[model samples]
Target chain A: MLSCKEAAALVSESLDRKLPLGQRIALRMHLLFCRFCRRFSRQVLFLRGTADRVRGEKEGEEPPVSDSLSAEAKEKIEQALKTHSESKSKP
Target chain B: MSIIDPSKGKGETLNPENWGKDYADYLFRYALVRLRDRQGAEDVVQETFLAALKGKDQFKGLSSERTWLVGILKHKMMDYFRKPSRELPVSGLITSEDPPEEFFDLNGKWQVKPSSWGDSPMDALEKKEFWKTFEACMSVLPGRLAQIFALREFEGLKNEEICNLFNVSTTNLNVMLFRSRMRLARCLETNWFGKKAKGE
Candidate 1:
């Protein structure tokens, strides 16, 4: 029987890649009996979905984008662009 | 006022000067979400613009300028993560330490069981405040783990690609991803789901 630790690792691994048939059955059996591992699996999946949404994967929903470049950083980037543009336009 | 007819391109013109004013925030947010560092995000955005400027003549108007610029931004992010110096040293711990111990015991059993987050946990995704907590939880992860997690969850890179990118065996990569998901799940429960359960 896969222990909860082994079960949890499989739970996470399943998200990244397809587990082999034998390990898949073992994880499924453990998840069937282990409510905690089941919840862990769901929450791990949820974390991915939530992250995708926040990264603007889902359309029509406004992501809660809280950060922005500071004024100094913006100015610096603008200056760099200006200098490059002028140098290119010259010789 | 420009070499090309800026107004003739359906407002998707390649005006490098106005790019910082127009797309800087959007591009920075895009990088920040994946990179999760303010300074790093800023640097990538700058690089993206510079590259876009250098390659403006190649713009074929096949896509919106934003989409084209975002394509360049994606490449910039990959290059940023690919740097050898940026790879964290803690990656070695994947071979040296036991990670599941954070939630599991030495007997390979769960030390702290996951609690029921109740039905419709999806509802939290719609709430703006929940994202605040989510970002907080994401930030709680160690840098390398978070980067790997972001690459998987946010960028949707396949496991094999990430393994090659990080130069880790699949086993080690899985362990790092497991640790990240476990910590994020635990943190969200403590900060968001657990709080909501108590009617907070």
Candidate 2:
């Protein structure tokens, strides 16, 4: 019987790669009896969903957060770009 | 928008004039979220614009201009993460003690069973404050661990690629990832879900 600790580790590892057949069966069997592990599996999936949002790659939708540049940073970038263009245009 | 006429060969015009108006805010926001530092994020955004200007002719236009700029910014962020100075203190993470035993009991059953997040994790994700809390949780992680998590989760890099970048064995990388995910999930549960459960 895979302990919850062992099962939880596999839960995370499974996200990275394919678990072997025996280990998969073991994990599944463990999860069957363990509501906690089931909740844990869901939590891991939730974490991935949140990560996708952070990456701005949520499927078929706009990003959840759309923070804009700060006004000061905007001014600084504009000034830098202006200087860059002027220098480039110079002989 | 009028300046982007492909037929006019204005596609070759890598104008810095419009970059700020068009892409600066978006890029800044992207960097700020990941870097989690206003000054560092601003610096990288500026560097990205300058680098894009220098290499603007290389913009094949296959991707959107924003996409192209984001590519530059991603690389810049990667460099920042890779810096030795940015590397977090390697006390707990680098040690052999990991995934601490307390997560399971003597018989290997859960010492602390994870609680359900209730229905619709999506609903929680949709909230703007959720990302802020998520960012806060991420910030609390050791810097390198957070960077690895960002590269995997945020940037969607393959484990193999990250292993190569960090030059650690797959085992070590997986351990790091497991720890990172566990920490973030627990933090979110405590800070976000737990608070919500209490009607906060």
Candidate 3:
């Protein structure tokens, strides 16, 4: 018999697809009889999808092209490229 | 829209410039899932690609190119989560002193019976708004608890790994994890599950 507390912890893991096989079955049976467990499971799935949507929206917004990288990073890239090209030409 | 990897010498071009939309789309979604913030996640993803381009030598192919990019994204997220306020203290999680094993029985029965719900479980969670509300709730958690929950739950890292990553003792980890789960459950209960007590 699982307690409400323990059952709740498994709910998130189950949705994430990480629960063990036996525990998965146990959870399924438990949810069959438990309203709270069922609600929690639904909520977790809902949360994953919603977060995904907001995530998509974020990536769609971007900083200007040239301004994206820092002055230091730009210099480092040039240095790496120069050294790599130079190294390839070594006899 | 170009995804250029200047350090990329002689391999298939993952240059976002050529596959800019696809690359950016993929990286953006990956970071967004973890950060739950659109602009912040995008910034991290962009930084990740730039960093990857610079340190292309660091990759030895233990994982796929995508996974490698995600690994870099994780480090970026670490910085985002490590706020100065995270230096604040957290109160105790459990005064009950119950062992984790107590949550599970030798015969594998739940300590508390689960309550039956209306129709299908999917029906309850089918709405996008439910998740929006849930994410909103999670974003407000105390910084330390949030880290512990994300690492252990989403990343699926082991207890030992979490200890090493966060430098906390096992007892401390247990308390933190227990607290994280409880607070998250409470949040979900309020935001998505409605305040109605079970079987009331």
Best by TM-score: 1
TM-score of chain A of 2: 0.76
* Poorest lDDT segment (10 consecutive residues) of candidate 3 chain B: B10-19
User: lDDT of each prediction vs. the true structure?
Assistant: 0.84, 0.79, 0.55
Q: What are the clashing pairs of model 2?
A: none
Using Cα atoms, each model's DockQ against the true complex is 0.69, 0.61, 0.10
Model 3, which residues run further than 4 Å from truth? A1-91, B1-12, B18-47, B57-67, B75-119, B123-126, B195-200
Query: What CA RMSD would you report for each candidate?
Result: 3.9, 3.4, 9.5
B121-180, model 1: which lDDT tens digit per residue? 999987889989988887888777888888998788898888888888888888889998
Give me the displacement of residue A29 in model 2, in angstroms.
Answer: 1.4
Question: What would you estimate as the lDDT of candidate 1?
Answer: 0.84
Cα lDDT tens digits for candidate 3, A2-79: 655566667754543477888877877888887766765665554454434433333334211111334443344445
Task: Give one digit per residue, the lDDT tens place, for model 1 in A2-77.
Answer: 9999898888888877899999999999999989889999999888778667556443333467778899999999
Fraction of native A-B contacts kept, per candidate: 0.73, 0.76, 0.04
lDDT of 3 by residue, B1-200 (tens): 54445465433324323223345556554555455556666667666766776677766554446666667878887776564443435342332254444444655444433333335534544465655555556677765566566666565567877676656676667656655554565566555555433532
Q: Show where candidate 2 strays beyond 4 Å.
A: A57-74, B1-15, B105-107
Backbone clashes (count) for model 3: 19
Consecutive 10-residue window with the lowest summed lDDT within model 1 chain A: A54-63
Minimal lDDT window, size 10, model 3 chain A: A59-68
Candidate 2's residue-wise lDDT over B67-99, tens digit each? 788899999988877776765455634433565
Q: Which ten residues in a row have the lowest lDDT in candidate 2 chain A?
A: A57-66
